[model samples]
Target: MYGAITAVKDLALTVRQGEFLTILGPSGSGKTTALMLLAGFISPSEGDILIGGRSVAAVPSYRRDQGIVFQSYALFPHLTVRRNLEFPLEMRGIKASERANRVDRILKRVHLKDFGGRMPSQLSGGQQQRVALARALIADPPVLLLDEPLGALDRNLREQMQGEIKSLHKEFGITTVCVTHDQEEALTLSDRIVVMRGGVIEQVDTPEALYDRPATLFAANFLGEANLLEETGSDVQAERSRPFGMVAIIRPERLRISTRGAPRSPDADQRQSVIGMVTDTVYAGAQRKYHVQAGTRMLTVREHVASGQQVYSPGDQVRLEWLRSDVRFVTP
Candidate 1:
């Protein structure tokens, strides 16, 4: 019951009462389908979804106590923001006075108290999103399911909303599950990130663990940019091969650049250094990214350029060195 095309596969994930878990994957990776199953929008073809140690596979969609916010604002066009926020409570038969009190509290929490009388079309994109969030939070459900809720906002607004959502989560300690393809959003917002590939869970860990010691090549490359260097039999014989089997994963920031023609240190290990020519350079506000051609592989390195220091240009020959401890071994 996930996605447009259903492919039945077993997936097991557990969420604590107030944990902020993010389900991260590319499109068609079954992340949205997973969320849909938990929200009771779609039932699994097989297997059960449990809540509070009880199986909820048979629970009806309307009966499940879950709050959902989608990528689109999904607000009613004719209804004012106040009415939109009250719809969920109205469905639950809450008293008008109680609903109004809850709605006002949430409207202020989302910073849309003044915009409550305005229509969804009358507000900015960010403000509309805040109203949608208020609508979801009005019910105070135990589980909050968000499907790319910030995807519609611009870059600056998206960042601002991310912080707002994080602060709200901390304030209320509500259990949340967010699905997104954006890696940076997952890293910044999630207490634990669940990486998915080909409709299955690839790895689950903290942001630092996923970035620093990815369990697989897919995990390493998916979380961020990683340069994979193949090691031949001769390279293995030369002690350049990693322990995982076939390739070594090096993070861009872990690489160190040294001027060519310098004497090698007597204690330097040959496997930890490579001679390469800088083929391209891209200036990032805080750091510069250099594309270095080493043998048949191209490696990316990020270096911070001080205000007064000279910057490296394209085609500059340099030696790339990194400590063995910085190298992550991944299976081919």
Candidate 2:
């Protein structure tokens, strides 16, 4: 409890074989603590951590057959690229010749074959990150632990590394558990995501399931941009269809925008529509976003950029429409 500061409580989860699992949460959410507990770096105050059906509560971090990559790419600055990769194998008492072969193969695999003679300080940020990943995978551990692996890279580099990491995971097929606060990164790389809040697991599910059908307000908001809406006053019961109050989640992308006074589509009768004024317009390269004021609530609507798509400007009146099924309910 850190002398009265409890980082994690009542948290439990399992990682399946040959799967990419991501632990997602904001700062101070115990995500890193959970990873440390699993890695045996920090022993659980009370409870057991099992691997292959055997509790490893007494196992030390060095004994655990897990590969770890940190945000800082913890490499020995004094060691060359090849030496850094060989450090793990050397610890396991592998012969020099065998270690050299393994390091050579891994360097080639990570496209750093020629840079083996260079030091970690001689490489770029992305290259250094690659070396760190290669070092982690060179040992061929059964489990790979990544703690904000891309938090150190720029936007373009982060995207590039995301693809590289995904490809490598496919090739290695090691059960992976990554920790990240970036929701998009989790959605991008994870087969399943574990959402945590205030030292507790909020939800665990596939990315699509978590985004499409969030069961809680925190889950709804954390995973993506959601318009939490609810009917109040007269017609609340009829429109909301819930005896108890709950918020309806509407994704910005799920909404459709049309100019005011336009004839509703044939399916409009079965869908929900609201009229609003275009308060603001945001132009992204591949898409456009509109902020519309409907009653007291401001709704966000997104439209993909297309050659013939109508672009709504600020101050223009518009109508937002979406299928009734798109409005999913979540507990407040």
Best by lDDT: 2
lDDT of 2 by residue, 1-332 (tens): 56798899988898999899999999999999999998888889898999878889899999988899999999999999999999999999999999999999999998899999999889999999999999999989989999999999999999999999999999999999999999989999999999999999999999999999888889988999887555311121223465366767788999899988889999877687777889899999898989988877788888899998888988998887888778777888
User: Using alpha carbons, what is the TM-score of model 2?
Assistant: 0.95
TM-score (C-alpha, index-matched) for candidate 1 = 0.92
* Candidate lDDT values, in order: 0.84, 0.89
Each candidate's TM vs. the true structure? 0.92, 0.95
* Model 1 ranges with Cα > 4 A deviation: 1-8, 231-241, 244-246, 262-271
lDDT of 1 by residue, 216-269 (tens): 888898899887755311132223455635467778998887777767766576
Q: Ten residues in a row with the worst lDDT in model 2? A: 231-240
Clashing residue pairs, backbone N/CA/C < 3 A, model 1: none
Model 1 sits at a Cα RMSD from the real structure of 2.8
How many pairs of residues collide in each model?
0, 0
